[model samples]
Target: MRINSLPLRVRLTLLMAMILSIACFSLMAALIYTARIVYVAPQLVPKVSTSEEMGREPLPVTIPSVPPIPSAPPIPSVPPVLIEQQINFASTGFLCVILIIASGSVLTYRVAGGALKPVTDLSKEIEEIDENNLYRQVQVPPSKDEVSRLSISFNRMIRKLEKSFTAHKHFTANAAHELKTPIAAMLARIEVVQLGGPPSLEEYKEALQDTQCNAERLNILVHDLLRMNADLNVAACVTFSAKELFQSILSELAAEVQSKDIDIEVHLEDIPVYGERNLLHRAFSNILHNAIKYNKPNGSIQITGTRHPDTTRITIADTGIGIPEDQTDKIFEPFYCVDKSRSRELGGNGLGLSITKAVIDKHSGSIQVQSAMGMGTTFEVQLPNASTVY
Candidate 1:
């Protein structure tokens, strides 16, 4: 049988059994060898006397003593009693060695199984967990041991799973509602036209314009959602200076900046950042767009950049409608809006910052906001310098 296919406990038990059995058998064999070396009698040869020193008389005498009478079965090479003793010793030694090997294997098997019992229980617990019962926590081992630590970790992981699952469910519902709202309006407008004999030329044009606007809003929302949820692992193929990257985004929003008559000041330092151009563009675009979108007309905006030891920092300070302290943390979550009515009125889908944060995180950077209501806001973004990235 292939050991690979065996259960962990069985494999462990067998491994321990094999190791103990080998050791026991080796020890028994060594004892037997030592007994033979130290306890067995050694044979000694008879010594011969020198003939020159004995110089004896040549008188012949024939004396056939008792030896001629019986050559009897040459007395057993080893005494019968000794042979019996040796046989008993050998038999007893073999029996003891066999018993020791058997008992040692059994004991090791049991000990190994006991040591792995906690792991086995953990496995069983994990196996029973599934989507339907993600809230069911694994039973933590009572002892403050490795097993308990593992159980605790598993519990934390499932808790996160539950939270994510809950969030996903919430997102799904909100997304459906958000999508449905615009479509329903557009459909209602068209149905009115259809029932009213297509209306006058001007009325038809008005309806088409409204429909087109809603369609565009829907398009932007769908695009933003796709981007926020995309597996967009962009490679750092090009390195761009921080100033130019920010300028490019600002240029894209120039029309809005013009419309708001917002004053922009640039104090950019020439610091190189390593990142995917498109991703950084999108991220900076969002930040600046937010700055532009929420700012009071003719508000002041400042863009600044600096070089730090490990990172390049870009700060965007805007005299826009500041976010409340409590809502700042939630701003980056998908579909979260501090002012739901205002967000809807402004056509904000609350996905831009979510996508921006994801992009920053992907580049191992960070973005943070400091703001107080009615006082304006500042956004700080830090990304690794070209030399330090990777």
Candidate 2:
């Protein structure tokens, strides 16, 4: 098998062994070569020979014969024993290197495996988790190492996933429930009209109108759902006058406002904000429609807009039946209404505020509502000013 394809522990062991072997072999070769160069016998110098030994004329002085000094013994050849010893040393070195590699590779494999044990365990723990067990968390190592940090981060990711999954499930359930109600109502009305035998034209008209109303409710609910999930095109954003946006919504709700005899006041400054105009229009329209739908006769509605250095703020206050304190926080939840019967009576599917909040969030803005039961309600919206939109 390819070296890289080996298990991590094996790969690490092999790499370490290879490095050690290279170093040992290099040192051994250098020592062996140096010994061969330096272990030779010392070279001898030739001694001067007498005239008789040279077979030439006698020396001028004719000095008495003296025992010829023996020439230094011919340079001794390297001993066979020494040669054998050198061979033995080289063999021993080679054997030692082989032994070291064997032992070191084993040790390295063990060490590598120990180092990766945490990762192995973490993988097993993660494998045990599934959608039903999303709440489960992997055991975090106490040591502040990468493994510990990884476990912590994984647990955090799991939490976020769990939260998202729960929200999705909740949204789906609510959507189903809301859709089922209108469909059942329509079916019930139709079934009644059919089972009542030959019905009069008035009865037929009444049943048809009821079915149409239910269908309208269904259409509105579906529209809100689609809008909430719609992708906003940031490239399509343009600077628009908030005052004009509110004015247009007010004009659309003029009949409702007049029928309720709700005195309306507009103190809007010409504040320019940047966002999708149609979406913003729908968001404010929902808010204004609620104000008109829930207001008491002769009640007053106040709309105001102001420009800030970085943001534009708009406030809509209406003398309507205010939300209960406990239910205020839940008003933006899909299909949630403080007064379900009243909301249904006013042709509301309880998604207006949810949609409004979604739109504002997409525009990088904030919205807040303050209300006291039976007193009034106020919605404040803040959007990035045109200068800050980019």
Highest-scoring model, TM-score: 1
Q: What stretches of model 1 exceed 4 Å from their correct place?
A: 41-87, 229-236, 258-261, 296-299
For 287-306, candidate 1 gives per-residue lDDT tens digits of 88889989999998999888
Question: What's the residue-level lDDT of 87 in candidate 1?
Answer: 79
Residue 6 displacement (Å), model 2: 4.0
lDDT of 2 by residue, 1-390 (tens): 787788777788889999989998999999888877776333223466888898999847665578667786675566778878888999998999899888988898899999999999999998988777878989999999999999999989989988888877988888899999989999999899989879999998999899898899888888889999998888878988777887888888888988989998988777786899999999999999998898889999998888889998999999999999988888988888888898877878789999999999999999999999889999999999767875
Candidates in order: C-alpha RMSD to true structure: 7.2, 8.0
Q: Which residue pairs clash in candidate 1? A: none
The local distance difference test score of each candidate is 0.83, 0.88
